[model samples]
Every structure is written in C-alpha cells, then in structure tokens.
Target: MKLLLTSGGIRNASIHKALLDLLGKPIEECAALCIPTAGYGHPMGSPEGAWRFVTGRRSICPMVELGWKSVGLLELTALPSIGAARWEPWVRGADALLVNGGDALYLAHWMRESGLAALLPSLEHTVWVGLSAGSMVMAPMVGEAFIETRPPITGEDRALGIVDFSIFPHLDHPGFDENTMACAEKWATEIGGLAYAIDDQTAIQVVDGEVQVISEGNWRCFAG
Candidate 1:
C-alpha cells in the first residue's frame, strides 16, 4: 500500500511535490475522495457550532489549488446504513483517498464499522492520504495525551494498524491546545513503540511498508 501521512493537509511545496511523485502524474489528472468523518464526531461548543465547524472546514480548496481534476467529499455518518458494495465504485474510481483530521478514534470506528477499512487494503491503485487524526488512525494505537476532545464512541484505544507505528501530529503547534513537544515526548515513552512526532510541515510516506520522511520543518521519531 502507498500512504502519505501528514500532520496537516498538503501545506507546502515539498509535500505537494511528494504527493505528485506518489501519484506519478500531474495533480490536474488526479481524482480524490475526501473523507471528513473524523471532523464530524468532534465536539464543538454546541450542535450549531459543530455543524458550522464541520461545514466550514469541508473544502476542496487545497486539492483544487494543486490542480486536481475532481474532489468528492464522503461523510462516514451517512454511510453506515448503506451497503459496503455501494461505495466500491467511488473508491475504485478515485486515484487517492484524502482523509481529514479531527478525532482519531471516531474515524477508526467508522472506518471499520462502515466497512471502509476492509476495502482499503485491496485498493492497490489508490493512494491513502491522511491528515492529522486521519494519519494517526492508520497506526496500531492512537495517543490521546495531546488531544483536547471528548472520549470516542467506540471506547477503543487501538486503531486500524495499517501502519505499524504511532504518530503524534501538530507537535509544538502554538495554535492548537495541549499539543507540545513535551506532550509528544511523554506519549512516546508511555506508548512504548516506534512513534513519530511531526509538525504541520512534515509528512511520513510509506510505500509497501518502506517508510520515508518528507519534510521542510522539524520532526522526530522515538523507538522504544
């Protein structure tokens, strides 16, 4: 499988270049399916607030800026009742799956419950592009030490385990709450496995289980 896991969405030229390289084509020729399920489960101050947050955050601007041909938004909440086979057409048609960030555990639950997780491994031609919580859910376990949110509905700590390591996103990001280098350091030690702490400017690219770090800023890996 090919994966591009990022602390944030495609943020810089270097990351953009890396993504294009993975696609092996110009962005203008690529089509992506944007999954915003993680952000749906996040708690805002109120229901209206949450709605606004989710709606406002749902945008294909980044991909459009990169010259992608088509970008479709697929919300997980709307898919649980639908048959998994119904989604195969969309999944198979896209060149990449762009997962947005919010609550990692929530995303994992839906990915499994909605049957997306099982279908992903078979998508040999589709690149999995993850942003923050989207990236974190691909690991065996998700570190919650730095996340400021309500507990997940699934009440499970383990993730999809598509990748063997854990990821700590937004390290030292001043704009976010409870995200710091110190928090990442403590979490890495507590989790006791291979972990990466990456800033918004960094990404981890895995091609057939071979890991590569693509970055223009700071990042660190802790192996315990």
Candidate 2:
C-alpha cells in the first residue's frame, strides 16, 4: 500500500509532487474520498465550522486546483454500525483516501469498529493520504503528549498498527496546541520506539514497505 502521512496537509511543491507520483495519473483523472470522522470529538466554534475543518477543504483545494475531478467527504459515523458492504464500494472506487486530523484515538476507534482497517489492506490501488491524527492512527500507538490538548475519547491507546513507527505531527507549530519539539521528544522517549517529528511542510511517504521522507521545511526522527 502507498501512504502519504503528513503533520499537516500538502504544503509544498515536493509533497504535492509526491502525491501525484503516488496517484500515478494526472490529477484530473483521480478521485478522492475525504474522511473527516477524526474531527468529531474536537473543540470548535460552530458545527458548520467544525464540519469544514474536519472535511479539510483547504487541504483538498490544491488537488482541485490541479484538476482533480471528484473529491467528496465521507463521515463514517453516519453509518449504523460496522459493516463493509455499505462503504467498501465507495472506498474501493476512489483513487485516493484523504484522512483528516483531530483525535487520534477517536479516529482509530471508528476505523476499528467500522471495519475500515480491515478493508484498507485490500485497497492496493488506493493511495492513503493522512494528516495529523490521521497519520498517528496508522501507527502502533499515538503519542501521549497530545492528551494535554485534547483528551482521548476512545480510552484506547493502541492504534491500527498499519505502520510500525509512531508519528508526532505539527512538531514545533507555534500556532497549534500541544505541538512542540519538546513534546515530540518526550513522546518518543515514552514510546520507547522509533518516532518521526514532522512539521506542516514535511511528510513521510511509504510505498511497498519502503519509507521516504519528503519535506520542504524541517523534520527529525527520534530512536528510543
């Protein structure tokens, strides 16, 4: 499977190029399904704004500008329960899956309970694009440091384990809460495993088990 995990969304030409490369086709021919379930537990000024934030319209705008034909939002929470038959076709039909960031544990919970995790491995042709909590949920566990800002809703620490290493998103982002280099360092040390600290301009690209760091700003990896 191909994964483009970012702290923020695509913020530079190189990351955009990396996404295009993963798509293996012109943007106009690609279709993407944006999953915004992660943002449900987050604090927001208004429901509408929260919806917009979780939908990640700003992040998907670049793809639209590049001529991406179809980009739509999918809220897994709207479903009655865990069932692949209802959503599997939508996921399979999309060329890419864009996951937004919010509460990692919440996202992981829905992914597990909704059977999304089980369907992911079969989506060999779909590129997985993750932002913040979206990236974190793919790892074995999420960094505890984020609890300082947003508490966990699922009460579960373990993530999907789709990827071996953990990710610390928005590292050193002054405008965001619970996002500092020191927090990343502390979380990496606590996890006692490899963790990547990536900022808005950086991303980790994984393809067929091969990992590559794509960045336009700065990033660091902590080995614990």
- What TM-score does each of the candidates earn? 0.88, 0.89
Q: lDDT of model 2 at residue 6?
A: 87
**What's the lDDT for all of these models?**
0.79, 0.78
Lowest-lDDT window of 10 residues in candidate 2? 57-66
Estimate the lDDT of model 1. 0.79
Per-residue lDDT of model 2, residues 3-37, tens digit only:
99988777788999999899999778999888878
After superposition, the stretches of candidate 2 with alpha carbons farther than 4 Å from their true spots are 44-46, 53-66, 148-154
- How does residue 18 of candidate 2 score in lDDT? 96
lDDT of 2: 0.78
